[model samples]
Structure formats: structure tokens, C-alpha cells
Target: MDFHLTPDEQAFRDEVRAFLDELLPPGRHPSDPEFLSTWQRRVREKRWVGFSWPREVGGGGGSIMQQVILKEEMAKRRAPALGTCFMGLAWVGPAIIEYGTEAQKQRFIPDILDGKVQWCTGYSEPGSGSDLASLQCRAVRDGDHYVVSGQKIWTSIAMWSQWMILLVRSDPAAQGKHDGITCLLVEMDSPGLTVRPIRNMSGTSIFAEVFLDDVRVPIEQRLGAEGEGWKVTVSALAHERSSIAEVEGLLRKLDELVELARASTKNGRPALDDDGIRRRIARFETRIAAMRMNGMRFLTKQLKGEPLGADTSINKLHRAALEIEMGDLALEIQGSDGALEKEIDGGRWQRFALSWPEVVIGGGTPNIQRNIIAERVLGLPKD
Candidate 1:
């Protein structure tokens, strides 16, 4: 694939552009809170904050092309999120360093690389979304503690997580629906959970619903055993398709939809001097350079160890149709000031076209990534 960069990955991309030019020095504003706690304590004293998780779990054991050049130089400086423990550094600390317990990696990998807490993901319910293994939520077990009871819905940041990673059903007669499920780690105050939130349509409650009632948990916060929760959710959805390193947040939303089509205006002037808006922004930069060469051919078959699966649903169905065609061409170049919110890019491309459910139904949708590329990458046949 020889996608260049290998003088030690161009000196690790010049040591991440000299630490973002000395800790975010351009026009400042890395979102402040004491400048993001001094840029998360200078990238957590250079461990580069979970840089690629492995150095005895606190992470930054780099390389995977230096974690794709430190997330493409922190998404070309949109910065802010190296680690605030969002979904506990995505995919619950690599599904607790691959199915936890060594005291769940000394109790949750040093508070998820020191961002303290916050993590949510229960795995859809309300009669299962995208047939998430027909989840029922149950739990049961008991004696050493298990109880649980149903309900999850949407979840994401479950009204400000404290911990979750759930998914239940403990063994309802085991037969199938990915067999008896079960993978815990709960907490959020436990005593019969609750949550609620859910707003969406971009009004944003960042999703929620939860519930539970007989909660409990304990048995050292179960994570692997009991019918192996669909093999710990198929090894945490195969390390969450390395979230195709969000192709640097869709190349910083196509450079803010090309500076909102050069300060928008059509028929009479600019709209990037239209040629059908520069052929739909050059077909969204050729489908974001074919999703960065299909994420570097799945990082060169994960650096040759191979075994990558369903070809990351072919870049998650080409990033859910290039984020709904670049949020409907940024509200069709803001025609009616894109349904106003005091326009001029203020409506934020009409709230990113009403934030399509974390991209047309989070994690799995676009018809379940085209049925995982028509039955596991085209072997086909499974109707």
C-alpha cells in the first residue's frame, strides 16, 4: 500500500506537529476550562493520552502509524478531545483492555487514563434497535449479586455517564438470540437505575432512557462470562471498527463545508462560484479520498497480523453516505439561511441536518451497514 510516511512515520509526523505547535498556539481557544486543563496536562505528560492503548493499559504505546498521526493532528486542530473519557476513551477502554478482570484492570484503567470518569453504552433496547441480538435486558444471577431488569433505549452519555457498558439477559433458556447474553459493569448509583433524557432532532439531550429497577450487579461487575454476552459483543464490535478514526472528523466536516461555500450566496454570486457547487464539493472530496484509502486498507491489515472483519462494513457504508451527503450540502448552501437559527453558519448547517442519529442511527444502521456488506463482506447468501 505504501501510503508514504515512514522515516519513523515522518518522525511521528514531526512529533505531532511539535505538540500542536506548543500546546495549541494558533488563535487559541481549545475550548478553555483552563485551556482544557492545560491541554489535558500537556497530553497527560506526553503519554499522549491513550495514544493507542497498550503500555500496561494507561496507553500511548503508539504506532498504528502513530495512531494515525495522532488522530490526524487532532483532527487538524479542532482539538479538545484527546481524552475526557468519552465512552471511556471510546469502546469502553478497548472493552476493558479486552474483556477485563485483573480486578478489571486495577479498577478501570487508571480512571480511563486519568480523565476521571464518564462512560455510557448499554446496547440498545426498547425491543432492540437494529436487532441488537434481540436484547431483553434481564440479568438474574443473584447470590453474589446480579438482579438488573430491562429497558435501555438509545443511551449515549446516559444523561452524563458514571459508568455503564451493560447489556443483559443472563441466560433466558440460552437457545439463541446470540445466546443468553450478559456483560455488565454498571453503577450510575445502582439502586434500581433510571436516567431518561433522549431529546434528539438536534435539540440534543445526547440520548438516554435507561431504567433497570432491580439493578444490583456486583459479582465483580461481570464482564466476560455468563453466556459470554455474544462473545463480549463480538469483541466489542471488533474494536468498534477502529471507528475508522473518523477520517479526521470527516476531514473536519469537509473544512466546514468549504467555509460554508465561501460565505454562501447563489444565482448571483459566490456559493463557491457554483458549477453545481463545484460538483457537489468535488463529490465530497472524492468520498473523503475513499475514506482515506479504506482507512489505510484497514491499517494494512492491522499491520499484517490480518483478521480484520467485514471490511469495516466498507467504511461503515461509506460513512453513512458521506454524512447524509455532507448534511444535505450544508443545507443546500443555506438557501433560506438554512432554516435560520440566526444563520450565517450559526444554525450550524441546521444543526448538522438535525444530527442524523449519530449518523443515520449510531454504530449500526444504513441497513445495518448493508447487512455487514451483504453477509460479511460479500460472501453473500444470508437474505
Candidate 2:
């Protein structure tokens, strides 16, 4: 793909930069709640929240290149997120746009873009362990509703989300494990639904164990046709795994890691002066640059209208390991102070190290990504 932008693309890039200049001027505090609220409102008005979704569904209908330009500009300015609903904006919105009914689109897409509600995913189970086809959560049809009864584990933000995009086994006896699965958009407050927050090593409870005991879901709330959830899940996971915004986040984290090294000490000198530390930092920079190039490659395929698939597992695998490594190195630079939760850098590195599950195991584990890449991308036989 050509690296140079077309005249229209250049114009869009300039527009994004100008907008950032107006909203994120010099000396502006990026983390102020009021400023972030205003920032979200301004960007939503400009239709940048769901920039690539269709205009009919309350999106900007921007080109892929234009969306990339928008994120690049926002990250450069260290601006607030485009909107407040993390899961909704990331994959749930895209999944709904691609597979939801017209009524579903009207009901959810607008709220998601407006950040009016939070959404949690109900994919993992106690034993599924990334083999999503093996999910055992059951939903039985009863007239105009399905009575769902099962448990979901590792559901992020379940304690606070207003809704969930859930998967249930509608026909367990189907010939193939992947078949007979169904997806539903369920209200979190529905009767018989329960959420139990699970505190992590980081002393946070962002993840929870969710229970559904004969929860009645109206037929109208079903996301797609019955027994077609695997297809929708594949699409959603692809979106979750492949994000250009993630590259920008890693870049920001790299900058922080560099500063942490400068402020740290090892062998009576600045840690940044240590030959080993310098080499590791250089490797990180080089790896991040390569990831950026790979992102552009994926963008090129998207521009050709090619749908993303298993190839995204490559980046997912890389990011999972890279995050853990970076976190560990940060703690190492801090030496013994790393053990204190309130020590240098406000214990951010320690928290990052302890919070590996969110990044390393959320979408899918590194081992799972390796399996997908080896079997689906490389055409290797399953073990």
C-alpha cells in the first residue's frame, strides 16, 4: 500500500489536527472530568465517536483512512477517549452495526455513541477457557421468550454495566459444537440475574462472575437468528483483537517507561544509563515501530474491503506478551520500591504488573491466539 495520502485524506487529517488544536490547546488539563465531558460531547457532535459506522445508524460514515487519522491526532494530543463506553465503543457497537436488527440498531447504537450506558460481554464461562464453542450456558425457548440459566466468569465491568451481549447454547445436541449457539442483548437488571465482583491481584474488581437463573429474555432482544452466534462472535473477537488505537496506547506507555527509567536508579546510577536497560528500551522502540507498520498493512487490507479474520491473532499474541514484559521491566527498574503500592510513580508499574489478566487474558489468552494463528493462518493441523 502507498504511504502517501490522497488530497482528500490530507484534508481530513488537517481537519482532525485543527479540531484537536481548538479543544486541546496549550496548558489544557487532559484529565479534568469537566474537560473530558466537554471533549466527548464535542467529538460526538462531530460524529467521531463511531466514525466508520454508517450515517443511518448515527455514525460519521468516515473513510477508513479518515478514522485512522482521527485516532492518530487524538493520541498525539493525549486527548480523552472518543466516548466513555469502553466495551460498547470497542466491539459491541461494531457487532451490532454488522448483525443487529433495525430495531436493535435504533435502540442501542445511538445510546452507545452517546455514552448513555455501559455494556459487558458474556462470552467466557467457568470451563470454556478460550474455546468459545465449548460454552455450556443454556437458553431454552418458551413462547416469546428464552429462559436462560447459566453462569459467566471473568465478565469485565459486569457490576456496573446496564446491558450485556451474551452467548447461550440454544441447541446443545447439535451435530457440531460451534452450531446451535445464540447471542442475546440482555438487560443487566433483569430478574434472576446476579453479579459478583471478583477482586484481582491489583486490588480492583473490574471483573466479576455473573449468574443467570431462569432469566427470561424476550425474543425481540435476540441479536441475530437463533443458532448463529459463532459467526457473530468471530466478528466481534476480530474487532476486539485488531485496534489501531492499541498501538497508540502502547506508544504512550513506552514514553512513560522511558521516563520511569530516567527517574530510577541501579548500581548507584540512573537506570536509564545502564547498558542492559538502554538495550531493552531500544528493542521496545523497534518492536513498537514494527507493530505500527503491521497496523498499516492491516489498514491497507481493510481499504480493499477485505474483512479482518484470524490474521489479527498475530498482533493479539504480540501485545499480550509485550505488555507483561513492559510491566515487569518497569517494576525491575524501581527495584525494591516496586513492592510498595504507594511508592515511586504512584505504584503504577506494580498495578500494571498485577493487572495482567485484563490485557493478557481478556479477549483471549496468548496460547489461544497462537492456536488460531497456527491452525487458521498457517494451515497447521490441530494438535
Candidate 2: residue 239 Cα off by (Å): 2.7
Candidate 1 lDDT over 210-301, as tens digits, reads: 99989888888888887787787677667663544577788778888988888878887989989988888888888878888877887888
Q: Using TM-score as the measure, which candidate wins?
A: 2
* Model 1 / residue 213 / CA error / Å: 5.4
lDDT of 2 at 101: 89
| Candidate 2 accuracy as lDDT | 0.88
TM-score for each predicted model, relative to the true structure = 0.34, 0.96
**Model 2: per-residue Cα lDDT at residue 161:** 98
Candidate 2 per-residue C-alpha lDDT over 266-374 given as tens digits, one digit per residue, 9 for 90 to 100: 9999999999999998888777777788888887888799876676777777687778889999988989988778788677788888887788887778898888788
Every candidate's CA RMSD = 19.9, 1.5
Clashing pairs in 2: none
lDDT at 204 for candidate 1?
71
Candidate 1 stretches greater than 4 Å from native? 1-120, 123-142, 147-182, 185-195, 201-206, 209-221, 225-237, 242-280, 290-296, 306-325, 340-352, 356-383
